[model samples]
Target chain A: MDARSPKRGRRRHGRFDVLWFLGVPILLIVAVEIVPMLGVVWISLTDYNPLEPDSWLSFVGGENYSRMLGDDLFWQSLLNTSYFALLYLPIAIFGAMVAAILLNQQLRGRLVFRGIFFMPVVVSWVVGSTMIMWFLDPSSGLPSMISESLGFGRLPQLLQDESTAMPTVAFVAIWKYFGYNTVIYLAGLQAIDSALDEAAKVDGASALRRFWHITLPGLRPVTAVVVMLNMIQAMRIFDPMMIMTNGGPNNSTTSTVLYVYRMAWDNLQFGYGSAITAVLSVIIFAIAGLQFWFFNRRSVER
Target chain B: MSVEAKHVQTPSRGAAGEGRLGKVVTYGLLSVGALVILGPFLWMVRSVVTPNEVLYSDSGGGIIPRQFTLDHIKDAFTAGVQPFDVYFVNSLIVTVIAVVSNVIFCGLAGFALARIEFVGRRAVTVVIVLMLAIPIESRIIPLYILASRSGLSNSYFGIALPLLVTSMGIFLMRQYVMTIPRELDEAAKVDGCSSWRLYWKIIFPICRPVIAAIAIFTFITAWNDYMWPLVIIQSQDMQTLPVAVGNMAVVKDQLRWGTLLAFSLLSVTPVLVFYLFLQRQFMAGITSGAVKG
Candidate 1:
């Protein structure tokens, strides 16, 4: 199979490789992603709702976008998303930074600590959410029992209560996420020159002074990235809110993504859902653009 | 001059003394922070083993379950809590297929992009980069429709196929492949190795670390995904771990907190075990290899 086989074998192999490697991926991407996205855009321009079969027969331009602006639920979702972002961004960034700094030091058993912290991040959110739900259960949960025992007298069930739902979701989201950010921060911290710390020490700086003046400033780019990424992620919150609250006793935990899902799937308002998604995409684009802008500005100044 | 040198050395010695105090504070803060991060996991283990009666007991100084029993574990295994077995199996199947498919395809695509200079290559690279910003939600509904139309809606292929070829996978693999020296390709070519043979025999082995990283990331992402499966699959028998666990936890009418907790504990063990073992690689994978452009 050596001499005469070379010509046939080479052609066959080349053909097979091209088909198997290049052709299949291109086909899969086109079939699954590109095609669907085009369909979504097409439907977004039409006044289509799965719930109303007749609406599919007609096309309307920008009407759905206009309706979305006046929709109260859309406004509520936007507000809810902003609030979620506000709560999640700072806690995740600062908590991760502090944890990363602590872990980055030559401490004992840092790997074990890192694993324990990051365990939740890799675990399915369903598991984490369910576990946290039990932890917060009013009647049978540990938190309520502790509260009652401590004479706080029956703490409200978090997921069921309007005021507590969104914040509680945020808390859990932070818990599940900070480990990833911490790891990123740890990576960033390692890149910093230790000579800066030594220089600060030689200048008679205190621990806090060194941290604020040198370490924090050194961590600015990472901080910017962490904050921006966290903000975007937090705004896209849905799974926990849906599982824990079902959009709540009163739409308290109705994040924008959740709202979009309900609109597109449950309410069957495809056009409206698409409009909301478009707005969200634009906003996210703007935020990320601003982050890049700030990053460039800082780099230039430095 | 000798007196001045002595004074300079004294301040350096004093700063060294301060460093020890700073070290103590740093370690103390870490210990407390570590406790906060790990506390919930400990509590979860306790809850899983604790009997319902103990869980619901009114008199409680600490919430740790007394007389730890295997009752919760027993019930979760026996009872049909949101079809636990089915969902677990479904998750395993999807994750395995997704990982294998993603790794091979991504590696091939990555190889082509990194080494080959062919027509349409630049366009392909640009498209992959731009699409990274687009989340699954943007294409989800349309994909759902396509899946339904194709009669693949509830099938594992339906859910796993789209995930198999992510832009992130391509991005990661491209970064990894670029780091391999071009000299190896030239050496292989001189040995009468074709381009595909060069990558397969020479390059793939050297890229094991990055490939392992990609595999772990893909596995975890597929295993943990909930929303898509929740939407597409209708059959309870086809439900994945996250979907099933979520359904159990959210059963509003008869919310069995104990059963829910038990199921949740069981479902996450596999993922946690995998993560605990490969965490360093996982961290490296996430942080490294940002696409330039």
Candidate 2:
């Protein structure tokens, strides 16, 4: 009451302002986000498809979820997503850390270097992934053309092959997204105390020792953030996979979200799609929650 | 804080400070990284202008174009199977609507959260944060149903609806507004300005930095978004740029690549131009995230 006593005039108009401001965004969020989310849960329990009115559109009680157990593509997509995560998580995190460390060294024209490095982050995924695909197209693309001209045989298809497709698309995504991670890491590096490094140098500590002790520990908080962001993004690797590989070459690069997209959009299997999405929501929720919980526990100890 | 402040003031720590060998190593590594980062865009540019015969021939992959032509660029606009012009206009319309909606809606919500002591404010903030956790993938099924049931499917409004405002935009704006001195709000009150007038005259101008940042983020995201547009616009005539490009990418053809690359480059040119103009603001917004987190 005491805190509220100083501003009675504004308080009279506060009701109208609240209705104007908070009401609109909250309603929009509910309509688009919150409602659709709950709708997914509701729709997942049925055998509903808007396209097929003749098909019984009634509650089937987890039939869609049960069906997923036998669905090879769903499982395969998860496996593919896991394979991608294995490549994406470490490379994206470590690549970004190294780039951030390099860019943070107070180097000349680091801004220019940073700007150049960050260019792909600004590019649309449809364009960026497609560009890489063009450069690597086995028959007519650069590597094969140049190789054949120099008396070498044709280069193998990186994208159209089962073995290399996932990794190649992973590389494309890493190239596009690493800059975002690097920028975050750069900020984390700036927040670290330079005085600690200077003191370590004065005490005859090696640069390696200074970095290992001070810099690495200083980056712990940001490391968790980058890891969490990449983990979630890696699982939902839709754009690059869809644009570059389309889960082709024996479905090597099909990601979970891409699978959801195909099932929901292409096949018009909204119920089954909602079931997949519900499952996906749980997995992502668990991953993010677990990481934050683990990181927070460690952070508390630190 | 002081070290970071020093960094902002003078962003360098130096080449001369290190020995010649260190300088050589750093510059060499930095240059390599930059080239690697830019290599894809360079390939796109080279292939976009090169004549198709040379581009597809044994000598196709050369860094320099063997023969130059403007026909491919013309084809990207006037000659492609998909109407690149329609895609361009649709994409522009969608992006403009999103940027405006996000700015106005999120800005109002952010202002209320930061400056007004409304009821359930804490609960609302927590809910907004929670909303960020719900992935777009998870919402796709019912989002589709919602679009069609609302009779907006195959329309621009349907494609841009889900993204008109986002939790991140609201959160970012709120954080920025919270940093602005509340004294301005109090002074505006003393001058008998209404709450909307206060926001317009005092808060809105002060919030320009964050406004620009959010608008740029919104523009880039709305411009690049492929999935929603893919689902919403069923008809080819109404398809956005990314959808058209996505379709082009799926076709397993070797001959039409010049057209493909040209369209892709054309789709990305506006973003590059916008970014170059606001590069400072763009990068600042990126760094702001990690610092706050």
lDDT to native, each model:
0.74, 0.81
Docking quality class, candidate 2: medium
Docking quality category of candidate 1 according to DockQ thresholds:
acceptable
Off by over 4 Å in 2: A1-13, A52-57, A145-152, B1-18, B286-293
TM-scores, all candidates, are 0.89, 0.93
Model 2 earns a TM-score of 0.93
Candidate 2 residue-wise lDDT, A61-106, digit = tens: 9899999999999999999999999987887899888878878876
Q: Candidate 1, what DockQ?
A: 0.36
Q: Which stretches of candidate 1 lie over 4 Å from their true place?
A: A1-20, A49-57, A203-205, A296-302, B1-28, B60-62, B81-83, B253-255, B287-293
Candidate 2 lDDT tens digits, B191-222: 77888888878788888988887788788888
Number of the top-ranking candidate, with lDDT as the measure: 2
RMSD of 1: 5.5
Q: Residue B119 in model 1: shift from native, Å?
A: 1.8
Q: For residues A1-302, could you state the per-residue lDDT of candidate 1 as single tens digits? A: 33655663334234345554567677777787677766666677776765465665568988888898788888998898888878887888898888887777655677877776676778777777777776666765566776788889777876777777888888778888878888888777777776667667768788677778777887888888877777768767888888888887688678888898998888887777777777777777677779878989999998
Candidate 1, residues B20-124, lDDT tens digits: the string is 785676667667766666666667788777766766666532565456777777777677744567777899999998999888888888777776765788898
